[model samples]
Target: MTQPTPDHHGIIYRRAALDEGYTDKQLTRRVDDATMTRIWSGAYVLNTGETRTPEELHRLTAIAAVTSSPDSGFALSHQSAGVLHGLSLLTPQLDRVHLSTGYATGARLEKRRHLHSGALDDADTVVVDGIRVTSLERTVVDIACSVGFAQALAAFDSALRNGADAAVIAEYLEGHKRGVGQARRALGHADAGAENAGESWGRAQLICAGLPTPRLQHEFYDDAGVFIARTDYDWLGKLAAEFDGMAKYQRHLADGETAFDAMRREKEREDALRRLGVMVIRWVWEDLRRNRVVPMVREWLDRLGIAA
Candidate 1:
């Protein structure tokens, strides 16, 4: 069996394997037995478990692809960089790894990777998870140029939450007008207070649905001024929206608590909010998938008789 070095980022390169005294046949056996996953031709990541979602596999591919090539030759960009930076990508393209090269590669497409050729200045790159990747500002500009408005807003919102400076994003946009206008529109909708990709996605849906923008991470208090809960989104006294996901559900758990216990705690929180006569709406991943979020949320807005 091959053991990865401390420096390895959850994957082992064949060259590194050889240096560690493993033969090709031995490594091949490991792959055959499900102990290793061959990500690229000569790159492997441990396969102790299955990739639960397409997003997980995409992230693994992006990181493994970085080590598959000559380390100094590729800089992670776009959604790949987002993955490395721990930023939430709403709907990332999973088919290809995105890389930036210092030289003019021009075409920007490869079978398993998309190589974007540009002037890669040191100032525009940052090392993340031991790999070179585009800075948050550059990443925002890159995704804004390529994806739809909602997807772009999700990336921008996550970027801000992960410490991307708004002024810095603007500074990078100078002289880089290819998609600056579109990016500006997305930025206008971006909120740093969006706690995760789900909230960002919800915000994007509200924007596309032509619903009034809701305040993010708003706190509420009871009649005696005791705190109730800090909501994911607030239409200020009208409606509060929570993008309900597994992550949100898990948060309901106290340490060592069971699933039912978590649900009980969440029920309590919801009840407390309702006793204040506040309308609360919750959506899950399925809502986003079927495009039902818009009409469903719109219904809530109308039913509540809230102008927003």
Candidate 2:
């Protein structure tokens, strides 16, 4: 077998492989031997034995779906385009590749591909990493209309942080009847201050539970005005909440600093906030998964005599 070559994006399509003088049998044998991964019907990516995140795998699959199709019928949309645009989706549908088509009249799902029919103008499409996809604002509005509130809020928050115009997103939602109510509400509360998907998700949970929306990325200073820390969620200058995802700690690690070292620094920062008479609450990913954030926060508020 000759050594196969993939394109710059590390994707090799069947037709391209055949045109390059590779036999169909060779491609089949490679897939059977686990040397190449069949991302879609005729698209392949070399297997390097490294596990890919769900987002990465879905991205490759979406690329394959678009490239392998016989015609230019659709562009990646919804959570598919969201991932490509670097938007964070709390609970994305990873198993299916979503494509938007202006020619089709409705939605269809088959063989792990979702075909959505909609009016996609020139303004609603963009090319990301060599693949056609819905623009950032369109992707956010699409996801907002198609999924749950928490997931929509996460995407909205991420889009805002990525410099997507809120007015443009609102314009996309204007007079759109599908999920405009919740999408509009999500946009109304979306904040660019959210540092990541986890913080956005935690805030969404609180809001869905009828809690007051907390101020995001609130900073604390010492008596002499020296900066102490910026919290994930701050309420009334009396309480602060931090989402304890491993990524959060990893992001703060300096050169030669272990995660433990970063954690120690975080503890000291929290201690400083405590000294300022602010109550600090921290929750991990498991808490969010188990739906304990609302009750836990409510309990803390009641115990601290803070008005909910």
Candidate 3:
């Protein structure tokens, strides 16, 4: 078969060889430009102006393409599905593609692909752009079962905020009889106001320590009736607690700036809030995981004449 000329987007491996058989040597010789870039091992691009690949879409497409037999089917699983469904507040660190199927099938993938075996019901699954994916509720349950508690809570929060019904998820869990316990527990602890995983974990820690639950994503208004600032958590009356996630602050640091400019900005924000009669207590990742934060929080509450 004769090789087709490269299109405007350049030649992709699947398109170049799948349509008409083209030997590897012939395809390689066609692209004499050294500027041609290799995305994965086989995927290549000749034009630099070509649009970059969307990672989520690429993952989904790979899963669909790999399932060649009737017994071979895949569902987007875990955090990967969460990202595709827009239930993830933060980007996933791991790039592995997750797939579920009843039959074992293998393919060379650009990234690690995890496989799970089970009969997927209609309610637990949905089709997105011709690809089967775990439903929003199922995705949340899978995340709760697989990832850390903090990440689970964040996923739950994003799902809730995006119009996922907690009751529907609960019913799905009950009927499925798989991961029901985890679903129930996660539902009980899920807080939509958690902006990130660290804040969610910090809230859970405080609750476990018997400290009174503070207002989440609480907004503070100045005396002039203007919105001054908002905090992750705020103790009503006098003592105010704020969870300072390390991830939150590190996101603001410059590439190599050694000066404490970020610290100075935080101090300013705190002082402004304090001027409005709100006592600010900051908690970081280490403090949240340890027992010290509990007592420190309680002490601040007691000093402010607020019962803890």
Which model scores highest in lDDT? 2
Per the 3 Å backbone cut-off, how many clashing residue pairs does candidate 1 have? 0
Write candidate 2's Cα lDDT for 1-308 as tens digits.
Answer: 46478887788988789998999999999999999988888888888889888998888888888887765858999989998998878878878888998763877997788888888899999999989999999999999998878788888999998889888999989858888899888888899898777888889889988887899989899999999989888888788999884468788789899989887888898899999999999898889999999998888878777777
Q: Candidate 1's residue-wise lDDT over 239-290, tens digit each?
A: 8878883457786667899888777777788788899987888888888878
By TM-score, highest first, what's the ranking?
2, 1, 3
Q: Give the TM-score of candidate 3.
A: 0.68
TM-score of 2: 0.93
Query: Which should have the higher lDDT, number 1 or number 3?
Result: 1
Which model scores highest in TM-score? 2
RMSD vs true structure, all candidates? 2.4, 1.9, 6.5
Q: Record all residue pairs in model 3 with backbone atoms less than 3 Å apart, i.e. clashing.
A: none
Judge candidate 1 at residue 306 and give its lDDT: 69
**Per-residue alpha-carbon lDDT of model 3 for 233-279, expressed as tens digits?**
88883566666643466577887743476676667778888898889
CA lDDT of 126 in candidate 1? Answer: 90
lDDT of every model, 2 decimals? 0.79, 0.87, 0.65
